[model samples]
Target: MGVLGQPINFGVSMLDDKRQEEERLQVLKGYEILDTPPDGAFDRITALAARFFQVPIATVSLVDEDRIWFKSRFGLSATEVERAPGLCASAIFSDKAYVVKNAIDDPRSLANPLVVGALGLRFYAAVPLVTHDGHRLGTMNVIDFEPRDFNAENEAALVEFAGLVIDQMEVRLAAHKAIGSLTTLIKTVPELGIDEVATVCAWTKKILIDGVWYSFDEFLSQKLGLTITHSIHPDAAKGF
Candidate 1:
């Protein structure tokens, strides 16, 4: 699967689906994004989504094990809602946009608390934030109190919005991972001077510590607690 390309892993056996769900949740956890502080990037996206859709609410929602956590919200007060099969939970099942033009008449949402209760939600549309590895993380969605038509163009635009959300997540995850690596490196080489990193043989890529040479990769794994893996780059694999 490509980051902003085709969808995958849909329509599988029930048992395989269960395993996939577990893997999906693991991928979500790896991001370490849940329950974190608000981010301006996400807030801006949701705000733009609300304005573009002319809706009262917009959100970047992440479906956790028991709740739908809002990474950012626009025009909505509550930070999160319980994970429900009728709402964001359902949206994450596919890469396509999920919509309810009129929740009052849509059987899928007829009994939902947000639809029948105080919030009185009447319209909703969402595009799932699917990762490059085919894991559906959550959604970039808009909500309205009144029903309205959502055309194909609108859906296409929403998909783009979802892609943006995924792109942001990818950047954020890389940053976090890099920081973690750096912190580990610093701790591992505490005696190294501020201006100097580690003593390494350039050609061999081996680090020297206390007169012993160690493979840079092994040194990182042993001293920094890092796991390294090799794989083809996503773009390069496209040629096949």
Candidate 2:
């Protein structure tokens, strides 16, 4: 039996870890948030987490291949660190919040460089940023220099904050899609003649092409042989 009184199942744990990592990477890529510029929305959440938990460090961390990058960080200088020997990497493996009261005392974390090295992180608590389809993208975590107990209440608050982060991600994705749709509409405007106007419904925003009325996107695809794609404008967010 392990410290938690459950049998330590190494084989099952390794298999599940592999499967979860594969699915997680796919879902993480879909968000299109990796290496993106910092946003106020994510920054506010991390700042609030640090204040609420009274911790010196907090972060909105996204676990990418080989390294975990901070989308937003409070009380930390380095933006990223290697996946191994990192608490946040372990946090992403579970659906619920993961907490370690003291890294120096925990067998799993005692050897971690962050625990014994310069950073000397002693306390850690994180809630996995899970998607609707049940993939853990990353974590929202708080760290402390001294060990501290993380109760159920603390976990709940962190989970709620993680939800807010996901909400912002979803909104940004929707906005990007809308911008792409609008750009495609403008691009397919079939070079109107001096006095010619394409038949379009003001209410529905559908266009009449040939003898049938079709949705703007569908009309463009069918009439102009163009595919609707999301493209970021140069003046907008630097790169999509």
- Highest lDDT scorer: 1
Q: What number of clashing residue pairs does each candidate have, in the order they appear?
A: 0, 0
Write the residue-wise lDDT of candidate 1 on 82-106 in tens digits.
5545676567765588899999999
* Residue-by-residue lDDT tens digits, candidate 2, 70-105: 899898776665555456656777677889999899
TM values, all candidates: 0.73, 0.70
**lDDT score, candidate 2, position 198:** 52
Deviation (Å) of 220 in candidate 1: 15
lDDT against the true structure, each candidate: 0.74, 0.72
